[model samples]
Structures are given as structure tokens and as C-alpha cells.
Target: MKLYQVRKGQFVFYKNELHKVYSVKPMFRQSVHLYRLKDMEQILTRAADIELYRPKHNDTFIFYGQRYTIDQYKKPEPGDYILITKPAPDLFDHYSLNEIEKVEEVHENSVTTTKDNGVKHHEYVMLVPGKSEASQEIAYYDKELVPEEQRLKDESISYLAEKDVTLQPYVGDIYLDKRNNTKAMVVAVTESEVTFGHGIHVHIAELLDEESFELIYRYSTD
Candidate 1:
């Protein structure tokens, strides 16, 4: 793991023991302060000496504020859309959905004296739904559903349209990008632009245009 990948409150392994990052100091050589999970003892380590803890099979972790379990890990190949939460060097600038044409794992010697073997690290890959695939799924659902069920769905959509509840996109809102029909979650909003995860930015006017994007879901604080 690189120094830039270390973030406070993230779980990592130091000296082969699970530890939580307590704090990070930016300096010529970044200083990472970690608390041992077993005994709560604070220890210091360098990025080169530690490894970002990889969850084992069935292990659970929060991704984008949602809890997910690790079912399996597959080697990433070309033209693969991978889901990643950690900072990947070139593939992702942030934790968001992205497509990578190629991926390679770089193995380096461990800086720690206790470990003689090198650490092998690679990007975790997971498949996500694409625009065409999603459209096909919706079409299949419409075809498979009974007439009464389809009628109910159509009526619900009409009812929502009749209500005319114009909802403003706020931070953390998830919407479907009508242009490509992919789901996106809002991360930031400005006067003229709205930014989504993975650095997707859209003009406020364009986002408000129903033809460009459709509001999917939003958490209610009430």
C-alpha cells in the first residue's frame, strides 16, 4: 500500500496484526499512527511496513455507506468494470464505479523485517450493471410480469407524475443518468454544477432536465 492510500479510521495490518488507523501526519515521510485492535495499544508504522487489510471471504465491510460482504475475488481483466473502495493508483481517483481496460498486479518486497516474503496486492474486481444490460433487464421484467402487475407499475408512475413533487438533488442523492442509463450518487452540489461519485459532474440545468437524469432514491432524514 502507498502512503497516499492510508486514511484515518480505516482498518489495516501492521506487523501482521489488525490495527485501526488513529491518525496520519503528512510530512516528508508520512507518519501513520495505528491502534492495535486486540489490546487498543497505539503504535506507529510507515506505509511501506503495513498492508491495507483485505477482507477474507464472507467478511463484511462498508462500501459507499452500504454494508457488503466479500463473496469472492477475481483477477481483473481488460475491459472490466471493477468496484473498489480503496484508493487505486490510476484506475480510480475516488471510491466509485469505473471501467478499466487493463489491470496488472505489482508485487514488491515487504519493508518490514519480520516478514521475509513480499506482499502481493491487486485491484479487487466486481461486475456492475451497464446501461444496455439494465435496459434489457427492465424489458424482461415487463415481459414476464402479469398484466395486473404491469398495470400497477404503470399506475404508480402516473401517480408520481401527477403529484409533481419536484425534488432538488442534494448531496448523497442517487439518480439514474438517462443519457447512459447508469446509476449515479451525488457527492457534491454547486450553484451551477452537481458532482457525483467517481467525479461525474453535470450542469444543474442538465440534471434538472428529466430527459437527462431521473431521481431514483434518496434517504429521508425525517
Candidate 2:
């Protein structure tokens, strides 16, 4: 390698174009960085409203102005987005202050409502960081409750469908063979497996397209 002394405002060759090295440290290459932080206004010529983006998680969707992370849809705050994490509205999403309007009359501790009007906006759902071992267990189990495998499959199907690929459904379309094909309808999907019946399940690999499910094959015959 040829060593060259760098001077300020002097353009030098890098990957392609000549980039002037402003800071040359004696050691640590990162210390000799090229790109400098700048105000975003200087970088863009036009102001575009829509963002071409992707979320880091399945339940996350970039919306309005920010990504709203939710397990289900109900109320969305400003800059909040919507999510379809569960097969149906979960217990948490079903509850609102309106349902509790008659709390003084009701003896029950819990009451729920279906949000028909629209979701209110909130910046965030501040969760109490796990305080005790019990809370930790609750958090752990709640994560396990997410059914990540099916969520992953849903994500996969979405991706392949976007690519216009010929994808297949799950194999456990009710542990289906030729005999029980008539009675099969998707019962439920879970993390790591699909449940078509009380005693039926299939892993993600067993499905033709873990992402875009069409059918499911049962794990066992008996």
C-alpha cells in the first residue's frame, strides 16, 4: 500500500471520486472519518412527504410520521401507526375509557368495548420496566404469546407476494392428507406451529411457503 500524507481541502481518491481527507489521525482509521454531519435541508433539493420505508418488526408499520408499534389496532395517536398482530382484537385493544363510564355501577373489575369511532393518538405506551421476578415472568410469557413463527410466515408471504413469486401455503392445512381434507379450515396459527385441530400442528418448514400459506399437512395421522 502506498502511504500519502493528507492535507485539508486536498481531494484524494477513495472508492470512486476524490474525497478530501480533512482529519488524518496517526492511529485508528475511524478517527480519520470522511463524512461530516450536516443539516438535512442542505442534502435534499425537493421535499417529499411519502417515505419509502420498511419496519424492523412484523407488528410495526410506518405511518403518518412515525412507526407505531402495537400488538393490535384500536386507537392510534399522532405519528402512531396501526398493526395487525393478533387474529382478532386482543383484550387490551378492546378496552377503552368509554366502556368504563359506568364503573361506579358495575361491581366487576374488568369491562371491555369495541372501539367503533376511531383510535385516539398517543405517542407511546409507557410500560413499567419489569420490577420483580413475577413481572419478568409476565414479560417473558407475553413475548412467547406473540406467536412469532406465524408472524414470521406472514412477513415472508408478504415479501414473496411483493416479488410475484409462486408461493405455497402451510402443510398442516389440518394435518391434511386425502382423508380429512374436507373438514379443514385454518383453525389458528401459533408461534413455531399451526393448529388445525385440538391434536394437530405443523412446523414452519413443513408449510410450502412459511410466508404465504395455502395449505397445511398434519404432523400425525392417528
TM values, all candidates: 0.26, 0.18
Q: Note each model's CA RMSD in angstroms.
A: 17.9, 21.6
TM-score of model number 2: 0.18
Local distance difference test, each candidate? 0.46, 0.27
Which parts of model 2 are misplaced by more than 4 Å?
1-175, 178-183, 209-222
| Candidate of highest lDDT | 1
Q: Report the C-alpha lDDT of model 1 over 1-222, residue by residue, as the tens digit.
A: 544577765667666445566567768364888755433346777878777754444443222112233433544333322333333443312222111111222235111111111112344434332222212221122234446564344324234333334545678889897645678898887643567775456544335434447888885677
lDDT of 1: 0.46
